[model samples]
Target: MALALLHTSPVHVPVFDALRDAHHPGFPLRHVVREELLAGAAARGPEAVAGEVTALVAELAAGGAAAVLCTCSTIGAVAEAAGSALAVPVLRVDRPMAAAAVRLGRVTVLATLASTLAPTRALLAEEARAAGLPGGDVRTVLVEGAWERFAAGDHDGCLDLVAAAADAVTGADVIVLAQGSMAAATARTTTALPVLSSPRPGLAAAVAAATRAAR
Candidate 1:
């Protein structure tokens, strides 16, 4: 059985592919990139494209994916909802990061896009509640102009902005990069506070889920 990944940006293809190669070599992966999905979510709202997102996820599951992972935070909740009715596992990439953040206490979330902020915040709250922790101390920061750079294919510019934003953050036990695309920024950040990104831990979780589903 293969693990299917639903991504909004094509950049994530290489990122996750490299991750799988390094960590879970020989694991089967199926990637589907729908830039329009995130485009619609950003232009309108995530709810506007909920049906399309859900349909795509159902299609992936039906196509023999042992597990489906939504790598976009904007439509993660909707994808997860669609997965609920399926036999296969459907996961949002940010969930593992959120679970980790809630345990750390006082999380500061950094995002390049305004659309990702609310959903990520909600995910953190849900994770906190599930873990019986208070969700009051989480903070969100939008790195101005970073999304524009990312959209223009300037990944380095985006990472620089994210790293700078992370360095500027204060009074937080840990910092969470709201988007998986921003995961590389963790290495560039100068702050001593722990920086959490979804890709590594999230992919690990997906691999484990796929392994179990295959059994």
Candidate 2:
């Protein structure tokens, strides 16, 4: 059985591919990238793309994908709701990371996109509830100008800003980098607080779910 991944940015293709190769070698992966999906979500909100997201997920599941992973945080809730309706395993990449964060007490979330903050916070709250914890104490920080730098192809500049934002955070038990692309910023942060990013844990969960479905 193969795992399917839905990504908004082409940058994530190689990142997840490499992760799968190293940790789950020989696993089959099908990647679908549609930049416009994220653009639409950012412009009009995730609900605006609910129909399309569900349709694409249904198509992938029907095509023999054991599990589908939505790597875009902006549209994650919609994708997950679609999965529930269709009886397919549709996992959001930020979930496992959010689960980890909720367990750590106060969480400070850092994001480059304005659209990512709400979804990430909501995911953390959901995870907290699922874990039988009180709704989490979550704070969101937007790294100003970082998204523009990323869009302009200045990846280093974007990450630099993200790292700076992470370093400035305080009174938090952990810091969560909201986007998979922001994972690189973790290395650049000097904060003593644990920093969490979705890609590694998320992909691992996807692999496990696909394996279970294949059985």
Candidate 3:
């Protein structure tokens, strides 16, 4: 079955590319974006800035999509609300990352997109509760322009920014790459701690959901 993946930036293309590259026929994928969708995710409050995502998802559904997967980590609630509103499988990419991050106990989420961290935190808290794990002590460090470099194919520049972000997560047991696009440079990551990316977990869940729905 085919899937419709939506995002607001081409910066996230690497993520969906990796997902489809690994999980082919079982999860054939297509992507669409509206650049303006990311306008406030790096600045305004989550509720105020990220609202455009849900609106766009609503529009994507009218075109006969079987399920909707939102790619932006910062605008998760808007995506979550859209999922509930549409009564379809609406999987926000960060939900899986947040759920798994909390399992590592004291964890730090390295987020380059500043605007989306709040809702992403809420998703992490919810994941903690579902796991019956104690509430987590989570910290966020934002790396400015990291995604831009990665999308531009500046491999070294992306890793350098991540190395700097790593310093922010020093005390934590694990550092979760807040942006899936940033996962491309995991090899150059200097942090000794295990680094987690959003795509592996998020795509796993979306594949499971889409598979079940297709069956």
Identify the leading candidate in terms of TM-score: 1
Please provide, for model 2 over 65-89, each residue's C-alpha lDDT reduced to its tens digit, 9 standing for 90 to 100.
Answer: 9999999999999999999966569
The digit string of per-residue lDDT tens for model 1 on 57-90 reads 9999989999999999999998999899999999
Clashes of 2: 0
Report the backbone clash tally of model 3.
Answer: 1
Q: Against the hidden reference, what TM-scores do the models get?
A: 0.99, 0.98, 0.86
TM-score ranking from best candidate downward: 1, 2, 3
lDDT score for residue 166 of model 1: 96
Candidate 1 lDDT at 28 equals 97
TM-score of 3: 0.86
Task: Give the candidates in order of lDDT, highest first.
Answer: 1, 2, 3
Q: Relative to the true structure, how large is the alpha-carbon lDDT of every model?
A: 0.95, 0.93, 0.73
